[model samples]
Each structure stands twice: as C-alpha cells, then as structure tokens.
Target: MAMGKTPGNRDDEGDEGVFAEINITPLTDIFLVLLIIFMVTSTVIVQQGPGGGAKAGLKVNLPKGGATDVTARSTDLSVAVLADGRYVLSGNVVTTDELKAAFDKARTENPETLVIVQADEGVPHGTVVQVMELAKKAGLAQLAIGVRDGE
Candidate 1:
C-alpha cells in the first residue's frame, strides 16, 4: 500500500491549492485615478462655468472694463443687482430693507469692509446708485464694482 502525501509536500500529482488572496493594488490604483479626475473637473466647473464667468451666485453678465483685478479679502461683501431689479446679498435674494440691515451689520463688524456690487449689464444706473447709497449710509466707506476682465 502507498502512503498519501501531506498537502505541503511535493508529490507526483503536481497539484497546488487555489490562490485565496486577492491582489487589490490594481483596483486601488484605478479608484485613485478616477477620484483625481473627478476632483479636477469639479473644480474647473465651479470656478468657471460654461459661460466662462467666475460667478458663484446669480448669473449676471458683467460689463467689460479696463480696471485691473481686485484681490478679494475676508472682509469683502458681495451684492448682486439683477436685470429684473432684484437684489441678491451673498447669494440670497433679499429685499431692500434686508439688504440695508445686512450692510449695517457688516459695517458694524468691520468698519473697513469693502462692498463689491455686481450688477448686470442691463440693470439701470439708478438701481446701482441706490445700492451704493445704501452701503454708504451703512457707514461702509470702501466700495467697488464687479466687472469682467477686458479682453
């Protein structure tokens, strides 16, 4: 009678057990690549939309201007004037009184805060003036206008 060989011993059968451990290096590499691509594309879409405008709020067609780029700061307050005479403060649609109150609060928090008015090209000059006056009345001395870079 012949004796059976152990599992680890070399035998004439030349049989090896199934490979139970799975290699996940390739799978992990593929996932990382996909994640990187998604992150990059999302950033581009957020910064510059299909219209190539760096707008994070309401879509306003900024007029061309020769002014240089103004670096944004922490104390900067953004207000948007839509073509339909609506006011948007920091992305929220606000009434005139609410806008005034927001301006007052911002001024109280930081006397040197700068208000950047982003008005659509079709917005009337008078509407923009009213917003500016409100800001001034709120004691916000520093003010600026948002414009598209002249090309």
Candidate 2:
C-alpha cells in the first residue's frame, strides 16, 4: 500500500483520483454569459424610456408622480413637448400657433375634450405653463399632465 492510499482503493490505470478541486471555468463562463445578457437588456430598457403610448416615435422622460388612473379616450387631445422645445400635437410636429389651433378645433368639436400634456423632464416650467394656458384659452376645461408612475 502506498502512503495515504487505502488497501481497498485500487489505483488502476483507468481509475482517476476524486476530483477534489472545483472546476470554476464553467461557472465563470455562466456568470459572464449572464452578465452579457443583463447588459443588453438594461441598455434596451434605458433607450426605450417612459411614455411610448399614442406617440410611437416620440421619446419623453416624464417626471415621476403619484399613482393615478389616466387612460386615453376618444375625446382626449394628446400633446407632447420635446426637450428641444418642439411641440407635437397628436403625433404631428407643430408650432405654438398650430397647437393652439388644434386645441381650439378639438374644443369646438367636443365641449368635454380633455387636453393631456406630455412634457419631457428637461422641459422648462414656463413651457408647460404655456401649454396649460393654451388649453385654458381654447376653452378646454379638463386638463391633465402626463407623468411617470412612481411613489
């Protein structure tokens, strides 16, 4: 019997010793793959920021707000304010005058029309206020601001 070898344990040519050391290669590979997957998914989520409904191509980072139920209705007039100071009314890029005109038209068509302003987080407060003023001047009584849902 050799040193540290038992009598019943045969050291045959085909019998390798017990694999005491753990093979970390496969574990490391799995971790790297998972890391890659997470990286890709996180980038996609960041690129596709909040508020993608109604306006498909427009990207607006809305400010966080409390939980509220705000759903789209046929009488709702949706407007978007981009960070670059551009206004989009019903998915069409428009000037301030154009937006006011659209709002007036909608209000005339439906007295109960609601104006929803979806402004980016970087937009100036004055701009948002201007939009609200436009809605008010257009005689649209109901107005709402779009905001991201959070605590």
Candidate 3:
C-alpha cells in the first residue's frame, strides 16, 4: 500500500493508503478463464481431424470403367507423350490412329489398369494433353502424369 508506511510517521493515522501497485488478481483470473476455454475448445478442434490443406479442393478421382480382359500388369504399361505430340503406349510409338487399338487391347485385359504417363519436361503441353485424351478415348480411365518430385 504505502511501501510499509513511513516508519514512525503515520500519514493516514489508522487508515492505510490506497494501493499504487497493479492488482494482478483480475489479470490472472482472466488468463485462467481464457486458458480453460482454449483447453475445452482445442479438443473439439483436434477431433474435427485434419484437412487436405490448400489442395483440399484439388482432389481428383480416377475413373471406374467397365471390367475388361486386361491383366493387372497392364497397369504398369508405359505412356509417353513425345515432343511431336505422339502418344506412345507400352513401347509402341503410336499416332492418334493406333491409340484406340492399344488402349482397348490393354483395357480389355486388366480391369484395374491405369495409364501413367511420363513425358519429357520440355515436351509441349499439347502433347501431354493428347496423351491424356488418347488414354481416355482408349477406354483407359485412370491417367496419371509423371513428374519429378520437388525438394
């Protein structure tokens, strides 16, 4: 209140002077209330689980097409998009004309076949698109593009 009074000098006589120090009781009370509130709400947040983050809306699903005669190994077939917009399926460099034959033949064997495309990074974007279009037209539903992983 008044630093321990002035020794023998009684400024307020029997009365104690007003407290000049900040009363931290109210601050401590408020912080404790906030801490408890956060503790309760944090569990709710944790229970809600994690989301896909910024790519949440970018989720894509592979197509589910009709069952075919192709084996599961067909899923490992190579798809390459050439710089000249050629579609290569399983080592057979194909023009647009041969895509249907290759694709249908693959699909007719493996029902779970997926076409994963690996093209030169320097290749034209249209070439990649052409490969995807060809895969779709060939009755192969799942098309995944190969890319180098980032650091």
Please list the C-alpha lDDT of all candidates, in the order they appear: 0.85, 0.82, 0.68
Best of the two (2, 3) by TM-score? 2
TM-score of each: 0.56, 0.55, 0.45
Candidate 2's TM-score reads 0.55
**Best model number under lDDT:** 1
Give the candidates in order of lDDT, highest first. Answer: 1, 2, 3
State the displacement of the C-alpha of residue 27, model 3, in Å, after optimal TM-score superposition.
33
Candidate 1 lDDT over residue span 26-83, tens digit each: 8999999999999989888877764554555466665667566676698899999999
Which candidate order results from sorting by TM-score in descending order? 1, 2, 3
Evaluate model 3: give its TM-score. 0.45
Model 3: CA > 4 A from native: 1-74, 149-151
lDDT of 3: 0.68
What ranges in model 2 sit over 4 Å off?
1-63, 66-68
Off by over 4 Å in 1: 1-68
**Residue 141 shift from truth in candidate 2, angstroms:** 1.3
Q: lDDT tens digits, residues 43-121, model 3? A: 6665554453444445565344333523335255567777666677667777777776777878888755787777875
